[model samples]
Structure formats: C-alpha cells, structure tokens
Target: MDLIAPVVLTRPAGRNAPLAAALRAAGLAVVEAPALKIERLAVAPPVLQVGDLCVFVSRQAVDACFDGRCAATPWPDGVRAAAVGAATAQALRLHVPADAILAPAEGAPPDSESLLAVIEAVGLVPGRAHIMRAQQGRDWLARQLQARGWSVYCHALYRRSPAIWDRDTCAILAGPGRCTLLLTSLEAVDAVADSLRRQAMDWPATLKLVTLHERIARRLQCIYADRPADALTVRLSAPDEAALFQAILASARSA
Candidate 1:
C-alpha cells in the first residue's frame, strides 16, 4: 500500500508535537492541527484529610496537577493515586511512589470501567476520591464512585476547548489525497466536525478517522453519516499514542 494520506494529529498542541515528530520519523506527512487547546487552570490541590485517592483522568491532567510546584509540595502520607491507563499512571508515578499508584490490571482494558472494577476488587471502602481532568469531561466514573458511597470531587485542572483554526489549517484539511484524523476525545470529534462545517471545506468522502474509543467513533459515525460506505472509522482498544500509531499504519496498509 502507498499510504500517502496526510495524517492529522488532533491532540492538544504541546501534546501533539511529540506524536507528530514520531509520525514524521515514520515517514508519514503530518498535519498538526489540534482540535482542542488545553489551558491549565491556576488552582492548587486542596488539603486532604487522609485516605483520599487522587485519580488522574489523562496525562494532561497530570501535567496540570503535578508538573510544577505541585510536585514540590510534600505529598501527604497514606494518600494513594489512581490512573485509568498506563500513560496516566506513568505520569502520576513521576510524583507519587509507584507502590502508591493504582491502575487497571494487566490484560484488562485501560479505561474507566476496567479501573473501576479493579478499585472495587481492591475493596476500597466508601471514601473521598478526586478526579483530576479537563473541564467539562465525562462524569461517569465519578458517578460510579459516588454510587458506592464514595465522596467524589472533580477537579478541573485544565480547560479544553475547540481550537481556533487559521487559514493554513483549513488548507491542510482541504488538501489533496485521503486524510486520516487521529482524534482522542469525544470533544475532539465534535470540534473537528464543527471546524469542518465552519470552514466550509469539502471534506473528502474517503477520509479515515482513528479514535481512541468506540464512543468517539460512534460520534464520528453520526457526524459523517452522509459519507460513502467505504469511509473508515477505526477505534483502538486503548487511548495511547502507541495504539493510535499502530492503528494508523494498519488501516493505511489495509486501505
């Protein structure tokens, strides 16, 4: 397969750079058009009484929460950290001790549901849990914890919003040949759709979309419902860069 389609990396700006560089090293032309702009909220972590497990929802959340002075603060003893995926776990582990970090079990899907199951099996009695993530992110996990009588707090460490595109971004999306979009979030799916609509570019019917989860793919399916049957919507089992790049290469070869 020729695999000449320009791959669009729709992760937030700083986060997209490394992935774009990696993709370029792999010989694929990359369009660095971020669908979301991540702005860290100027807030500090509230003092915990004890036994509160801080849950980081994404790597961005980790950066916002602990990349700076937050890491300098004395980490309270007896508090644990939880991450929904390996990437988030790695980020959390940078500040918290590895033994204090909880993540989805090996071989299980690296997602909220799987992490929740592991938390259940670990028998963490109803207590306080804080979910650190972007503003306006999903509350399903928090609700699940709450159902079990855990007092859940959602700390919006960063703000995520649709990226304001320039003329170059419009040109790239409207450029020649088939394009594959690597979208990692549901908000990103909507952002791309909205950007395309606003730009009034004729999106290629044969475009391929790679999403991190099935729910994002379902949203894309709705957005691109008018497309022809051959258009592809690929969903990876995990929401990480490695899985995304692998899916991209596989789909490109198959296409």
Candidate 2:
C-alpha cells in the first residue's frame, strides 16, 4: 500500500468497509474518517402501511426498513417508488418494485429537484404520497406536494449524526496521511473538520478527496482554500461509491 496514498473514507461506518477494500486494491492505505452517524427510526407497523407513494431517500433508509423489525409482507401493490439518485434508485429496485424512479443526468448530482420532477409526472395529490428518509432532511418535495394539493407524510427512517474523531485519527489527518476522503454530504465534511480542530491539528491537504456532486465539490474547494489556497480535490460527477472508486482508480493510474 502507498503509505503516503491513504484514502480518507468519510462515509458512514456501514459503508466504509467496501470503500476501504477498493482503495486497498489500488495499493493505497485506508484511513477511515467516517463523519456521518446513521440510526434507524422505529414506526408502528399498522400506522405506516397506508401510503400510496413510498419514497426511499437514501440507501440506508431502505436497509433499516428491513432490519427484522418491520413486516415481511410486500409493500402495498398500489404504491409507487421514488429514489434520490441512480444508485439509490437501483438499491430500491433490488427489494421493491419502483414504479417511478428519477435521477439526474449520469454526471450530475441526484438531488431533491430531480426527484420532484418525477413526482410531478405522477400527478400526486395531497396526502397521497409518503416520503421515507433520514430523521431530518430537505422539505422541498413535501412542501411542493402539499402546494399541489398532495398530502405528503414524511416518516423519518433514520437519523444522521457526526462521527467523533479519536486522538489517533485526528493526528493522522493532521499529517500527510495520504488518505482519499470520499465526501457524500456537506454535513459530513464539516463534521470531520470540526472534529480535527477539537484535536488541535492542522487540516492538511495531502490526502485525495472525492465528492459525489458539484455543489459539494465547490463547498469543499471553498473550505479547503480558506486554509491552503491549493488543496488537491476531485468531483466524481455521480452520487455513488462505485463510480467514485472507479474515478479514483483511473486518476491514480493516469498519475
């Protein structure tokens, strides 16, 4: 492994292992700095079974839904499925049959706007749709659906918290640890930086950074530039780990 080429995995803990393996294959050391904490929400079986449109906001939400606490019964037949991105949409497809899945262009961020476009096509009426995602997130779709006379019920399927950095981990990131940081959310990036500062270490720019969207990419550039005008970073142009890993492999091969 490239001791100087450590990959900084800032995804959730449930997601870091696969990414770690991917970097190891590229002969790079893996320094996991998971900045997001995920917790599943509990819902009564009978109460949640009355929605026409069922949406999965993130892959984690779908996983938590089937963690042996919910009914094994198939989703309601009349229910329609929606996902935030191509990858998440694909994950939803693995279990439930999604009737209407929307995504951004292959090289763009799969955001709330893209999901809203598909929801609009369904002609959703108020109270007919149900959104399932993290404990808290953007309410744009819910508000839009309500404005369109669609009743939207958002059930918090999970909660995202920040990962607490230990002293050892803080020391590594402050140094030239050569870890590639995969940032999927802005909150996670901010958390990682805050954790480091609490440890009294400099935020070094020696590690490779991979992001899933241009907005997040720009946000990182601004934050990193504030400290060291030139920090090497790259945007993966997609909201997925596989795509980001492929981009990393290709970049390293070319370098």
Root-mean-square deviation of each candidate, in angstroms? 2.1, 3.0
Tell me the lDDT of model 1 at 101.
84
In candidate 2 the C-alpha lDDT for residue 251 amounts to 45
- Give the least accurate 10-residue stretch of model 2, judged by summed lDDT: 43-52
Per-model TM against the reference: 0.90, 0.84
Off by over 4 Å in 1: 68-70, 235-237
lDDT (tens digit, per residue) of candidate 2 on 19-100: 6787788786677778888877776322444446666677886676656344566656655667778777778776675454
Q: Candidate 1 residues 99-196, lDDT tens each?
A: 87889865456679988987888887678898988889878899999999999999888899898676568667546666777878788877876777
lDDT of each candidate versus the true structure? 0.77, 0.68
Residue 78 alpha-carbon offset, candidate 2, angstroms: 1.6
